[model samples]
Target: MADQYAHSGEDKRPTETPAIRWEEPPEGPVLVLLDQTRLPAEEMELVCTDASALVEAIRSLAVRGAPLLGIAGAYGVALAAVRGFDVDEAAAALAGARPTAVNLAVGVRRALGAYRAALAEGGDGRRAAEAALAAARALHREDAEASARMAGHGLALLDELLPAGGHRVLTHCNTGALVSGGEGTAFAVALAAHRAGRLRRLWVDETRPLLQGARLTAYEAARSGMAYTLLTDNAAGSLFAAGEVDAVLIGADRIAADGSVANKVGSYPLAVLARYHHVPFIVVAPVTTVDPDTPDGASIEVEQRAGHEVTEITAPQASVAGAGGGIAVAPLGTQAYNPAFDVTPPELVTAIVTEEGVVSPVTSEALAELCARARRTTAR
Candidate 1:
């Protein structure tokens, strides 16, 4: 199974591909995405000529990851404005595509606001559209810079927590260049450790139901020439018991004001295990992921996916009828409870790493201060 999903024994970094980009065709501007659903086996691009197409792409997981979703959302609005579509309608649809990631809504609103401001200042339709595009580009650039700074701060935190040189880190889901404009959140720190020769091994969780870890993280690890091993999500306990894991790192989808983090479904379990073992479980994300309006974990909404994703498995090599596609793994009418994300309370989290800095012993007061500082900086 690992052989099927990863290119093991490869020691060279793979060529980087921009996960999302704006393309100008003679017809009009479109949003282009590297289809993540068809990854590891096929490299394909999905072109979105309108807001509806982009919405379907988000829903289908053709383009994913929290940071990348924001970039795609802002660009979607820009595409709409440049193509003479209803700007307000486009912003509403794009922002609604995914509710779990606050960055998506934030990006859409920033671009929409820029467009509205320019129009109110006596700018024509074309000038307003240009303002929206400029806003989207600015957001894109800022995300890339944030990724870099987050990597630096996270690595520093790792060094402080673990005085010893060689580190064995465990991570969940997919956080790499495929997920953000720069390297990534948690994964970027790991990459930095590898470059500094401080990394011993990267234990990857084969995030189930979607296998984002197996198909995506492993792919990235191999490409970057990192010493990594793919394991079933349940196998992590054995590693902790054996004293093989030194820390746990993961990226967040949404972080509430109280510092609770919502991430991939399997992440909360890892956090629990890390806490029990006295290992540092770090949550890494950009400041944009923090939602001050969300008072606590209970207030955040988790997106539930379709039952088919859990009930069926896709194997391209099976010979049985329909087995090569989405073969059924359960009863036809069986109901599967599939929540796309799970929240980890701040108490379980050892620290939260953002582009600004690290918040250890995560508390409501500490998180609130960080958010306030970020707002003050942004206002300038």
Candidate 2:
């Protein structure tokens, strides 16, 4: 994909295409999302008029990422309210659609709260729906602001940690404009560095069993004109050994109170590598990604996906689809371990950069204080 770049002075700062948007059609309100599953090959939008369709999109990863999931969940609730579905039931289903990302539930409850509040004040169903839509819009705008703030904080931290300037950053999974209301978590930080001329190369880890880095992150990098190279997940160790990596940046699905990060499956290994190589391993996410109710990594639920995702290989070069749209790579009846995400212990992480601030040493106290400060600020 990088080879296809037309270096003719094109603006490479990631197109301002939204991953999700709330639309009010003549028929009713609908949630429109870019179909992420068809990425790097096709730019398709999934227009969902009901909660069930939105749930399917979430489960199938058509709309993903922690921050984006929150935004989508809020919009899902608003869609239900406007369409006259039972708001509580719709919120429940949307929240449960993907349990690993706490942001989904958080976003759902926020909009649901607004709807209930408006209804309690004697508003009609339509008025309540309007309140829900307003809440969803607020969450959406907040997420975009959080993304921008996180990018600023993360880039400053990178400069502080690696003062020599040009940085070779290694990233796992996808975190860019496609994943958030604004430029995404870790990738947004990298993008900031690139824009500042401080980024040398971005080593994208081809996250196995999913290839999110190869298919999504690489696509975003190519469009942004970032100097990037794609490599197998295992090859990161070689890069670390050769001192080719200055830092490892990644986004989290859920961050526990103890500052343990639950991110894509390969993130833990990269954290271990970064620790071994004495490189800065930073987690960039909004404060909403932190779950204070979850005490530690052991308490975070790791989602287990279907074995077929691991047992089969799906590539654009494939001639034909197998039984379930992917050509089988493993022998028939073979079992595979396919955990959707892995938890990285706080000790392995050098810092957690959020829109609120940076949590260095990543202690429980630091995380709590950051969240507390953010709450107070928001209250004001």
| Residue lDDT tens for model 2, 1-380 | 00011122234344544688877778666787877776766666778888998898888888899999999999889988988898999999999998889999999999999999999999999999999999999998998899999999999999999999999999999999888888899999999999999999999999998799999999899998899999999999999999999999999999999999999999999999998989999999999999999999999999998898888877643665555569888788898999999999999999999999899989999999999999998999
Question: Candidate 2, 84: how far from true, in Å?
Answer: 0.7
Alpha-carbon local distance difference test for all models:
0.87, 0.89
Q: Count the backbone clashes (under 3 Å) in each candidate.
A: 0, 0
Which portions of model 2 miss their true places by more than 4 Å?
A: 1-14, 316-319
Best-performing candidate as measured by TM-score: 2
Model 2 alpha-carbon miss at residue 144, Å: 0.7
lDDT of 1 by residue, 268-296 (tens): 99999998999999999998999999999
The estimated TM-scores of all candidates read: 0.94, 0.95
Measured by lDDT, the strongest candidate is 2
